[model samples]
Target: MAEPEDKTRRAPLDAVGRFTATEAVAAALSLIWLVAVAAYSFTAPDGTGPLGIVMTLMMVFLPIALIWVTVTTLRSVQELRAEATRLQSAVESMRNAYVTTQVQPSVQRKLEEIERTAKQAETALATFTSRRDASLVVASADRKAAMAAPARAAPAEDQPALALGTPAEDLRAPLSVGDFIRALQFPESPEDKDGFRALRLALEDRAVAKLIRAAQDVLTLLSQEGIFMDDLKPERARPELWRSFAQGERGRGISGLGGIRDRSSLALTAGRMREDPIFRDAAHHFLRTFDRTFAEFEKTATDAELVDLADTRTARAFMLFGRVAGVFD
Candidate 1:
């Protein structure tokens, strides 16, 4: 409604025949000059020849022609004014957009959240890097210590052998499937006392200890390539599918168990397998270890326990690395 009213409003130069104040004033002056010229042409003291008639006609219309030309120039000026108004409107809209962006609440919060997550990932990666090297050192040193142990403590030939002391692991309770899954996730942080406790208990089991060590090595190596189990979100397979895998099913029958579908992760793993010999070896070792250990555990694991195990970070890594290794194909 307001737009219609604005369109109807008067302008100096409109679509209809109209004149500006200056143009009207100029026309009035030109009319007066024509009247004076008519009076002189009729009442001239000199002879009224054809030359005098020609001069009078020129004087009559020249001022009106000049005024008409000036009005056309003023119409061009009016168009320029309209364009300047539109440009001013566009500038105002841009300023309003800038103000709106500044007031959005999530902008600042999202930035902070992203920064915090990146720092946490960096810390976890660094921790595992050290653990990977330490595990290698500890495994080699243990081999050396075990080989030297028999020579250091020789059995007596005649004297009665003293009763052998109980092994260190005999004092600790056996690791349960639940504890094994928790241990595979590893301690969330230094303050995660419960998580650490579960890991320590799981480590007491001879078979589980080997699987956990292999998992840690593969996890640490994958992190070096910027892939983390925490970042993967595998599509959860059915418990029956997991049971089939545990029961030695292979190929497409159990292919649904490979739930990791992130293309970028698969590409990275495939590339690493092709280019990095150490990473490829570690991946193969982890998968074989996981498959054998998990099959044994599945014999006793309830459907709920199986689901929980599948949800563990270690299981997720298996899905990702195994798919790239053609375990699901």
Candidate 2:
């Protein structure tokens, strides 16, 4: 086929190889002409005999050899130009990659420096605010003392016994912020102590106990849904993370929850509390109890052995879940 012939075609490396091939062709032609001339001279002793024949053949073959050389030279030039273009493109690509590599670290360092500066500014602001708050507290105490001194001295002997704020008479009664504030005040006398005892007794009522049981049921439900109390703690310190978890984007804030496993269970449990009648009533009761109790509860009671009842993990969960469900609204 023509393909095999094309592959096997002679290609000269340089002008020297072309010249050598041309000379070889000329030498072969000259030898043939001499042989022809010798035979003709013997036949006719004066011979212009083969001279015309040799010149005609030379004219015909020389041009063919020149044309072959010109074509090969043009093909080689095209191949060289193609290789150069490819090399230029590769070099451009490498330059872009090198620039990206060189710039990344400096950009990253600049970003880190900005973050550090922002943190330092936040720390300074926090310190200044704390100092300002402390000074204001001291000044307010001084103002109160100055205003109350005369009135306090005259009424010290005649003042009636102070009373402690107790739980409301009705379990479902809505409590006000002012009622809670008054309840959180320190017990100052035997009468106040008696009031706190009565309040504590009232908190043990069956209806209030049902609220605690309801909170426990919620905890159990979450357990079945594959969420746990320990899992909620780390989130407690982070408001946004906790918010995400409560919003049904459970896996968004917890990396472990991102796995496909437990995904379906979480989906099934997401709004079940709101949908189920039993859980809905329990949630309502728990929220009502929590709101009224939290209002009347003393913040300092968390550390007190007798009144540390509301400081448990279960109680904390109720408060957190109540907030997320808009129960305290």
Candidate 3:
């Protein structure tokens, strides 16, 4: 059955509208002319010849035919316009149906997850910048000196121990793997005293500090390309895989460790590696430092600690650069 009429449809006299005033006038005038000519032809003038009769017939049919052609053209145009409207409606319906069927929860979840990560990174950056010149900086310097002093120490006989049996260096216990991992992540906020404390301890370990500084350099370079270590989401490889890479395995043997698969990031990094010699050198140095540090870290670090360390921003940066450099093939 035909659907109920659309009241708003003004389309081309398909259902509701009447013929226009001009069309109606033309049709009425043509019919009047035809009737008048027929009547005049019947009451022919006396002595009229065949020429006059032909002329009468010509006048009778010509105007009517022209008006019929005009009306037919208008109807064709109206039908064309109606067809166009139906085509547009069909397209709109198809688009809405496609959108309804194609959208999925996974894509929405991924976007939401990405947004949350970005917010967290922004918060961490703002917090770190505000506290950059506070007590943290001072403690950092003191820690560096304390760390270096141990290296430049005089003979054991020449230097005296602290009260009781504690050496000056022994006052603080060794930096634990947990603290090292925390330092790699850096302070999340000015109020996170534990984060700050772990960083300070990490700085006091000369080896770890050197690695930290190298990682910092690489991170700074990466930022110029709008890539952030915090934004990277590398696949978490097993601790055994990292240990395998640290033990001098290369190519596919440790390839799983390089989980940074973002094509744009890799392309930008690859371009920089080829064009900038200084950046290339620094990246290589950072990789070496990370490799060495992780080797030592894994020896005493539990599997969970190793995974946490791998997830840190510093380690993420390493994964990005390492993948680009083909360190893990």
Candidate 4:
């Protein structure tokens, strides 16, 4: 009875195996049919049987149709891949930008705070230095006074006090045309090409001679009007102007014509005169002369004459003034 039961189980197992094997064989045969159809359609020549001709035509038509479907499938897959890559890159870029934007403001604020603190410190240092210098001057004055008292007592009979000499005239005068030309010849850099050209043209123009004469006349008139009262008074002339003049002079060593060689220098000088009470009165006198001179010159001058004037020495001087005033530089 047990043997019969075992035989029943074995029979069912055998049937299941047979069914699986049959299905596998059928699937393989279907694949072989598809392959054979494809190969036969492609390899078959023309002018054969009607069935063979039909198969050949089908082969041609079928491949074209299949190619489109294959290409579409491949293109879809490529598009999906590209889209995925773009999305990933965009997400990464956005994350980086967000991080940078969030961090930058705090850094900028700290930098600003540091700069403000540095400026405050500089101001405090300058103030302290000024006060210290003033104290030193006061102490020196006291020492001189104490020494003068003893000298005065002995000066009547035994020792004669030395007479003080007048202040020495500056040996180095204001820049001359020759000096300006020389400076242009040896400019500090290639950037001075335009300036060199302008200067050269002005030097060649006879109108520049007239312009210089006019400028000198203007200067004389200003002096006569007492606008230059402080030209004789060292105390009245601000140290700043002298310093600027000195710097301009020094710049001549490198470029020959310093910042003071331009039109802005003339304007600055005029502005300074305006600020001074005595100079302002003198400037008014010169202003009238300037207006009259300029009007006459303009009225008499044609465009050609004006161009000639621009090409002269006076124009070069004007250009120099402009450069000094920071307009050109």
lDDT minimum window of 10 residues, candidate 2 = 141-150
**What is the Å distance of residue 201 in model 1 from its true position?**
2.2
> Considering TM-score, which of the candidate structures 2 and 4 is the better prediction for this target?
2
Residue 259 miss distance in model 2 (angstroms) = 23
Clash-forming residue pairs, model 1: none
Residue 218, model 1: lDDT of 90
Question: Compared to the true structure, candidate 3 yields what TM-score?
Answer: 0.58
TM-score of each: 0.58, 0.30, 0.58, 0.26
**Native-vs-model 2 lDDT?**
0.45
Candidate 3 C-alpha lDDT tens digits along 135-236: 322223222222222345555996776567655446666666567778898888899998889888888777889988898899889999889876777776
All-Cα superposition RMSD per candidate: 12.7, 17.6, 11.7, 26.3
Give the Cα RMSD of candidate 4: 26.3
In the range 1-329, model 2's lDDT, one tens digit per residue, is 45563211223233335545545665676566667755765686452568966865565556556665765676577556656666776788899999999999999999989966865565455334432233323322112211111123343666665565533443333322222222222133567864354334333444344444566567666676576544442111222222233344432243321222233443444476657877566656665665444433322111121122322444455544554454333
Model 1 agreement with the true structure over 1-329: per-residue lDDT tens digits: 44553332333236235556867777788888888977886697764799976776677787778887887777678766766666776788899999989867678899878976865564455334432233323322112211111124567888777567857665654565556778888988899997898788767777788888999999998898899888887876767788888888888888898899889888988999999999999999999999888887765555555666787888998999879988888
**Candidate 3, run of 10 with poorest lDDT:** 140-149
